[model samples]
Target: MEPPDFVRFGRAICCDLVQASRREWWLADGLGGYAGGTIAQCLTRRYHGLLIAPANPPLGRFLVFVKADATLHDNERNWPLFTNCWGSGAVEPQGLVHIESFRLDGSIPVWRFAIGDLILEQCIWMEREQHTTCIAWRLANAVERPVHLGIDLLVNSRNHHADTRPYGFNSIIEGNVNRISIGRAGGPTLHFHTDDGQLFARHQWIEDFDLPRERERGLPDRDSHFCAAHMRLPLRTEWSGLVATMSTTPEAPATDSPLRCGEMLNRRRAHDAARLTAAVTLTPELHDAPCWVRQLVIAADSFPIVQPVSAKETKKELNEKEQDRQGRFGQRKESVIAGYPWFGDWTRDTMIALPGLMLTTGRYASARNILTTLAGFVDRGMVPNMFPDDGGQPQYNTVDGALWYFEAWRAYIAVSNDVAALREIYPLLQEMVSWHLRGTRHRIGVDASDGLLSAGDSGIQLTWMDAKLGDWVVTPRHGKPVEVNALWFNALMCMAEFSRLLKKDAEIFETLAKQAKVGFSRFLKPAGGLYDVLDGPEGNDDSIRPNQILAVTLHYSPLTPQAQAKVVAETGRHLFTSYGLRSLAPEHPGYRGRYEGGVWERDSAYHQGPVWSWLLPHFAMAEYRVTGDAELAQSRLAPIHDHLLDAGLGTISEIFDGEPPHSPRGAPSQAWSVACILAAWVTLERARPSAREGMAKKEESRQ
Candidate 1:
């Protein structure tokens, strides 16, 4: 099979420890489990691990297997093939010096190490829908005589969000010749198996492992892991390595059972090939997309995961026909994990990401599931802001989440045209609007006088600019937020259309939408563009932010053509960056250019001036609407195509530093970031000749 072309780095980057360590690779199992590490094979963040799976299905994640520090032994001399960072600021073994190249073969990360005449290749991947991670190494070239290797198997059992402590778990190690099991009482056990190896139990505590990335974030930088066993293995020309899994079911450890490394790797390759093939089959246009774009389509598969819903609870209030419809789709609902290594399934991110990740990629069923599932959880007309990581109750804090829900449905029905599903969900959408029209949690409701949505309270961050440190709410946009009303106006218009399509009375929705549009004029600043917030505690906020761009980008924009053009021009002039738009323009006094330092420092800068890649789609769409130049608007997204190779391989980062070089920060692989960019690119591609012709006609008329 031919290898997939996504990204590749040669000795120029692989040989440089700084450059190599900064570039990270991530793989997901579609079950909230993942494996990630730097190209240098060193653990820089506490989150970096070989296997991290949820102990509570899709929540309550635990770091199961940390790393397998490998060593090559030829006769008497020994060479460490893995790198480690120590607490005293020392990088030991410097294993990266032996590296020759690194590349991503689909979702799999492959590293090649050149040692004299022999070259060793290492790869890491996770099985789909299972908490199994496979780490394999192969001899790329022929090596005379037998080459022996020693691998120190490290394991940990603690909440993935916490810092590692010494003796965090009284791990009990049980191992035979080729199999090892490590766990504490009443906890999940990790089963380790190697195709060709001898395992020996060694429960040793290795402490003071330095986590530079954690330290940079002002988090706990020191960590400890238990070396549960030692494995001695032989290397061959083909492939041979280890598999670790937390599955203790009837089919426990079934992934690598055949015990052949070549077959194990082939299975992963085939699975990835099928994913790409299915994407092309669903969306034929993807067949001609650039390699990076296709890679993003594969990356898109990692975010949505199955979270089972209770039939009794979901159907308790529905009628027989709705129950039958729900049964047809099954009780399993999918949610888009906002971002990997940290974030949970956030409603705002899920809805905002639904179009690009699911619709653009042709995963219509999954998109429908997400929308319906979240609709079931809507309370007081508000969709959940976030579902807690512990699988507890969902939080309803954001005003924009439910507003975005309307847009997500609009985008879904545009693609799927499943009116039956729309009919089922339409009432729920109307109920949400009703709740907003009245009053809901977090002081989110429409203003009676202005007919505009007003949301937020003291110490509550209701909008997407939400970043909190202790009791302090950063970006406290409490009244008449620009995007919320933009969404409110857009939602009302969508309801009018949805009502019309369903043969329901559309007059009420149309009248409400018209009133909201007239009220939306309050957001327009006399100087130009829209105010960031109106009637706030300090009165109307004239801060130039990316939020105003949404007023023009949404399907039912309230802005007139002239006003829309002005907003786009102002945004492009002040907030536009190569990667995305800055959260806050530099001219604003409250703007913080760099997103770094401790919790308070970082949270303060989180929305102040960092560039959010997700907003690029809004800007791109708005630019297209104003200029009618699809090419110019599409060119705005060019930097992201190259960004797939940086920071996070084949995926996009959550945010970039507001300053130059725009160092990637926050989550390495963000759902909305990838989804929005791909969505905008596809949208622009479809608008093509028509957009060009529109511009040409205007030019002729002016002449």
Candidate 2:
């Protein structure tokens, strides 16, 4: 299992501080915990850490271990193998210059450093389903004499969202030669273990570590880490590593020897291999796809995690089989984290990303589990908008999440054809429609006269363009938004189809779909394109936005062929960029070119001008639908292929600057951005000459 060529970087990239610091790598544990940092091995965001695990099982994350600052020691001299940005604007050690090359060895970030005569390698990864992180280092080549490593084990226990103060709490450190335990009293404990290393308990407060990225985001710019201990280990051609685990409760003493670093590497490699194999077996189109697309297949595996079920939710109707599974695996469900660093499982993002992140990658069980899990939280005809990080009740503030749910289910059935699952979930789907047709929360209900869904109020944003700061809803599209109604029409049509498949009455849904289609025509402006919102406080909004592209891209588009083509052409003429479609046309008076400044400033420009990668797929699909040119449509996605190496390393960023030379911004790794791109790519592939031929042969054999 070799990594894709596009992901590997040489000294030209790895040796430069600016470039290396911008390229981040992330690894997930499949339990909603992760390890990530820049290629420079410097902490940029407060979220950058070697170990961040859930203190409350999935979302209540705590950064337990900051990093293991490493130094290489030879006969007479030594050099630091890590980099740190100081508060006084100095980069000490400047360790990035020592790197010979950097590449993701199948999602694990590996860096090779030219240390005098020896080449040293370092890599970090997390164990799946457990709160354990491993950092392994090796002497890639032979050395003249014995070369040792001095590792300053920096540890911290702070809410991942909060900054730390020096000695904020007293920590008790007790360890022997090969093991160490560091934790604050009555809090989580971090157990550090190694196969071959000498550990010594030490305490020092390293403060004033500058977080440049946080400063850029207008946040607190300084942090501190407690040096809990130090370790000395000799590097060999074979791997030697340290493992750290967080125990929220009491645990038994460790008598077993730590697993060898080589074994851990092999386990991760085997898992990567199996994922690729299963993906190809399930979706054969990927077998001959480009390397970047395959790389995305590996990237897609990072978002879905096991969200622990709450005590209240677990008391819902459960069958014998469900109870047994819960008893064995603990009470947990599947969900997708919307983005890394500072996002929880958002329903809209999860459903919007489902087909791409799950179905396209042959993760049907995970897909079903995610849908089922979210289904349990549906209320007032809407799925919970997001799961709060503090383990509070799920928020239900979105008008389109439920609409996207219908589409997610439609995508699932299109691939799996599992009628039994559809039948089981159909009733709840019907209830969702009923709630929308009547009145639900947030004034969300179908207008009796127009049949279009209306939602939102003062100071509220219910659409994906949601960006708020204090009481100011930046994109408060408080009415029947173009995309929301488009989704409504699509959802109604989906219900009609699902009804037919399940031997239920389809006439009502069919009639509603017809009514919504008729109502949707009001969005078509006389000058072309569609309105951004209708029946708002100020009447119809004529802003040219990417939201109207949904009118043509969805599975059950209500627009006619001519109308769809007009919308596509109008959007391309105004909003299309190399990376994605801009949120607002530059001609608009309110458009902001750069998504910079502080929170209020950024939120104001968030939907006003920034180009969203997620909408690029919608535009691509719309263009393909209108022109029937799958190759040309897929070419729209070309800019992002190189982008995989730029921002999040193998993943995609949440958004980009609306201007030229679109710089990646926002969450480094976004679920919808990657999901939408891969889903559109696979979809466009089906219309290719080769893919069509394959499908024809398969169809002929079935006949």
Candidate 3:
């Protein structure tokens, strides 16, 4: 069998491919059947599909099972079932369609659907012999005559419950065979299963839905109904030859009745299946294979809906085919090198992830290309935080994105020994430092008070927990955050290193390093501890935050190992959580435990108390370096590695609840989360005490 293709677009993995009507997109495994949201919406219209799936691991195969105008239950008002599908046209109302599944065999679950002039037949084949499950879809010919038909597959596993209310959907079902009801304002509840602890093998489609009348082709209305009856057994034997046919009569020019095709609906089921088989066989060889193919296959078994198309295509796809062309070529280029799924829009994420996800995996040229792509975006020393989805312009909202660029640049240089590239990025690095001095919005203004940068007050949470809620900064350090200073110090050090390599401006290098040292000293509190911030009058919050850890972990810091140990010990005592370091300690009194209720309620706890899995690796590295305690570092990081495999399916999550039993929150498969893990792994393995001789040799070469 061919290896599944993984398409990387920004920070997502698109795993499987399917096209309904003219719209096209890919699916991810974790999001669960239709569980990945919005990523699968019709290209021509919004709100066309449903992503019904899980939020955590065991990213079984995702089902892009599609239907027209399905009536999904409305759990909010408990009202009768409502339709939430997209409208056929700008002014038309879409109708409701219904879908359900039943187990036909112990290993096969047959999917059934009823929709407007259409019937869907699908099944989950558990190929135990191959240790894989295959999800297959076949659309029966239902029209009276051979009328051209267009069908789009829409799955919404985002809302675990098949109900209309978004609230109930947010609550995760923790047990196997968890069931929920979708009833009208006091109507009978429809039973459904949220989790079935089985892996989905692969999604196999027998036929494509092709509707003629290109201009008139559109998805169903908003309120299009959706529901899935998950069966425990395999679907191969349950309803093998099940079929449904609808009778219809073609309306005359003056008639407004739905077009009918009575005789065509009664065609032989075997004939339909045969046609579908032919279509499936020929699809890969089609003149214009859909761009979603590569991504969908890779995402078929992972979380996060992956869109492999570059940020550049996000806008261009609105009107032309150029975006598709570019996306196809990009996918082809990546396929040859066994590259991981990547998204070009996220500069920081891509660069941060390049080494582990690409270079270390042996795609060196692609890694170089990714760096070069980001290098092109550097303007006046500022690398972009993200490339806008529509590709019009790049935004620089993040202060750390540029800093990470330098780190990634260093990593690239280490791997390729590319001094020329380092030299080229040096001036850009200088420009970024200059931009920081000039003060770009957000009191990230260079502080004349301590010579250490003072950032915050712009209502932006620059140090991650980046979500904003009105004027209330969630994890605000209104003056200077420890990590920002650490990065600033490291950036200067990197520039100094690069300058030496270029054999240029030794005096300038000394001056920059001196300034950085001064800044580091001033930021150190007189109490013999590194303060988390440099707020005046109010003084430092002294909340044990991970920001201070960077001061030791980064290559350049003025603090001695003893001081580093002090900061690390202080932070470890107060901030460390069993899962990872808490964004804020429980002692702060504002910490929230559970992260699954409402949006703000969840975000408030997001940084205030959440245990970020990504930070553990960094903290472990810092702890190891500070105390030279190999056992301590292993103790800190080992559980987290196990946790990643358990909760994230061999990846890492963005954040976890601050409280006990710290549940993972935020995006699963987050780029930084993965980067931090990979980077920390590299740090620990290379810096192991047993590797002391190797380290000495490496240090001598540097000297």
TM-score of each: 0.94, 0.96, 0.56
Tens digits of per-residue lDDT for model 2, 575-669: 99988999999999999979888887888899999999999999999999999999999999988888998989999999999998999989989
Q: For candidate 2, what is the total of clashing residue pairs?
A: 0
> TM-score ranking from best to worst?
2, 1, 3
lDDT score, candidate 3: 0.44
lDDT values, one for every candidate:
0.85, 0.87, 0.44
Worst 10 residues of 3 by lDDT: 242-251
Q: Give the TM-score of candidate 2.
A: 0.96
**What residue runs in model 3 are displaced by over 4 Å at the alpha carbon?**
1-355, 387-393, 441-445, 448-450, 526-528, 536-539, 689-703
Minimal lDDT window, size 10, model 1: 307-316
lDDT (Cα, tens digit) per residue for candidate 3, span 1-703: 1221221111111111121122123222211222211112222222222222212211222122233221222222111112222233331122212333221221122334444544555443221111112334445534443222122222222222122322322211121333322223212122222121121111222112222211222222133223322222211212221111110111111212222212112222232233223322332221122222211112212322232223343322333443333333243222011111222235556655555554433345555555654544455455666544233455656666677777667777776778766665566577777877777755555665445766665566665456567887766666776777777767767777777778877565467557766877765666655777767337776666677777887667667888888877767887777666787767777766566655567656666777776677767878888877765675665555444323223345567777667766655445555545545554555556755566567559979
User: Lowest lDDT 10-mer window, candidate 2?
Assistant: 323-332
> Could you give candidate 1's per-residue lDDT for residues 345-394 as a string of tens digits?
78899999999889887789889888887766677788778867776666
Tell me which residue pairs clash in candidate 1: none
